[model samples]
Target chain A: MEKITSLADLKRIKEQVQSKIKLREQSASAEKLVQIRVGMATCGIASGAKETMSFLIEETEHQAIDAVITQTGCMGYCYAEPTVEVTLPGRQPVIFGHVNRERAREIIDRYIIKGELIDGMIPVNFKTIDE
Target chain B: MKTIADHILDIVQNSTRAGANLIEIIVVEDRKRNLYVVEIQDNGAGMSPEVLKQATNPFFTSRKTRKVGLGLSLLKQNAEQAGGGLQLFSAPGKGTTVQATFQFDHLDRPAPGDLAEVFLLAAIGHDKVRFCYRHTTGSGSFSIDTAELAETLGEVSLAVGEVRRAVAELIQNNLEAIGATR
Candidate 1:
């Protein structure tokens, strides 16, 4: 697999992904359905982000929280390298820091399931274009 | 490193950071049989035999800034905890493959996190590396070739907001079909 080196290369990749959109939709309906984002920046990896992310994935399926967990690069908070942002349907996105499997479970239970705010949040700073 | 995706993103970085020109990420989910597998392969400067053997140890790292390398070690642990396992294979100059498997029915098994976002990040974040993402669920599967996507968009960033949203929607629909819901 050669790394894509340019925007041209990326465009080509996206086109390939588009053809598979139908399959993706089918899979989503059959499997679990929650949106999870794990920070995988260099700092995050160094801080045990892998374990944290995997924990979230495994647990969601185990508990069946209607979830789809994925990874993102560099949330820009190096100090909180292993951070996780979870968003359930009809809920605001919540960012949790220093998360391990234990914390992941708590987030799933309290936030994802019960819609309760948990303790380890980094104050929201950046605003998306939507906001 | 507990979640499979987190572990994957971290490990994949090693390949990119090492100047890997091509990277492939494959994810398979089997609902009928109850299994989920993730494999990341890269053609970068592979680790030496000795380094490969020690890569799973928390204390061994190739980086100078840190005295410990917990990425692979913690990933292995997370896999085991979820009634799954992890493996790493590498050859100097050839490339490396890291695979992790989980029993979907196990109480410890995690859910499928957002993958579309991950794919976009991998494609857009690293301008010099090529990423190939293949996702499968039971009877169906799809692939994303960053190189191909780039070719289609032309003179524009293929990873634009629209592309990101579409990918996200695609993932959402796939998970839904599989009866995955939060």
Candidate 2:
């Protein structure tokens, strides 16, 4: 693949990606993009949050999901390291634990895309991964 | 942090939490000089003298949720283990800068994990804040300024799939070009 070396290259990318942005903007929920926060603290990184985060970024890109993925500090759920909090449009944010690459894909497919809760949905004071 | 890339992400989070609107990550590797330097500078809410004094202690933290702040301590450990040291500078309201230096050929130096992935993740989600990365090796140097990238992006978000891919590729290619290790 060719290297992206200059600001002109980014300008070209912006032009190429504009059509897709326009298509989404024309929809009723144009202002709403899925928001994902991956924990990247020591515990999260130790548990492979970097891999989880990179996978989420690639998967969302490949699937063309209108989502913004970002990193956050630990959410006090160190036991469930590599946790991901997903917020869909106006829905309440859902945090999923033990979100390895497999679980991240499942979250995107089942929870974010289909609006169905998966097994890893975390609740307060619960250690599901331990049991 | 397991690798230099991981530590970059972890410490950048600390800057974000401090309400830093501008974060600078710099890495310089010169084998001839035997110097491997990693620095993070932020224009965030700085720490007080008392807090700064104990900042490297694992048990001292500003967050109410936990009693331990291991970010600095761990980085300090990593630096010392690699035949270098960590330096910190901060003021009450100015900002904070964390710099860690290592011997370029030190056996204990952590591997350079994935710099591209780390850079990509750092720039996303914080539209208001700007993250700039400057990486240099003996061969050459490369840099990414979010302010310039934002101008090019216009209203498009950095997290957009194609844009994200492009930015990641840009960082990766630049890193390789500069003779940076993976």
Candidate 3:
């Protein structure tokens, strides 16, 4: 692909990608796709959440995994910042703490791809008031 | 904390949390003036005088999730240590603006870090909020508003993988053209 220099270039690329997205029906409904949420609050940023989030986005896209990667505020896990919450389709969200680039790779390989839970997952022990 | 980009990402998160729909991040690199400035202005729920007084206190945070709010405090310290200062302007219903200045050539100054990445992630994380990033150097300047980009792309979302990468490239290339460091 050519280097994006202006909005016109962006618009042209969007047309191409839109066609690809249409082919992937799984990517159509956001809930059915994988959801990766990275904590991006002050605590998470200080612990390098930006790199982890970038790695997650790049890794997933590179592997062609239909996933939604986003940023969230602190999950009250300031001690174990750079935390990531991954939710598979129709599954409960599981959070992993202290995520670096390497750890994020492991997440894509083990948990996301293979469906095998890994260590270092912050167990969701408490219930919210809504629950 | 470590880099001005990191602080920018963190501070922007605060803006989103404060209910801002439009957040503007401005970075100025002025070697001639010996100044590097990072300013984040938000159209969020603004702060009152009493709350603003304690905003820089490391131990004070408005959220119940944690006791300490080190975002502003850390930025303030980083600015002062680098021979500059931090200022905040806000009114109850007006909004908030955070501006921190540093001596551009100070030995204690932190690197700019990955500014393009910051813009990408900031836009991705807060999809509902529109972010505007303006970077200026002595040579030239570039500014991008997410709303405008979204309009240009029509219905395509910026978070799309290909679009996101393109957006990053757009920012990185523009910053380079303007002679921004890192």
Best by DockQ: 3
Select the stronger candidate by TM-score from 2 and 3. Answer: 3
Candidate 1: segments with Cα more than 4 A from true spot: A1-42, A45-131, B174-182
In model 3, the Cα lDDT at residue A119 comes to 90
lDDT of 3 by residue, A24-102 (tens): 4434587778988898889999898988998998898788888888888885789998899888988888889989998
Ordered by TM-score, highest first, the candidates read 3, 2, 1
Best by TM-score: 3
Model 1, first chain, TM-score of 0.69
TM-score per prediction, in order, is 0.60, 0.90, 0.92
What overall lDDT, based on C-alpha atoms, would model 3 receive against the true structure?
0.87
Question: How would you encode candidate 1's per-residue C-alpha lDDT over A84-125 as one tens digit per residue?
Answer: 877666556667887877887788888888887779887773
Please give the TM-score of chain B in predicted model 1: 0.89
Q: Worst lDDT window (10 residues) for model 2 chain A?
A: A122-131
Model-by-model lDDT, in order? 0.67, 0.84, 0.87
Model 2 agreement with the true structure over A1-131: per-residue lDDT tens digits: 45686778878988988876755445436348888888888788889998998899889878878777777887677788898888888877778999999999999999988998789778773321210
Fnat for every candidate: 0.14, 0.74, 0.75
DockQ of 2: 0.52
Model 3 clash number: 0
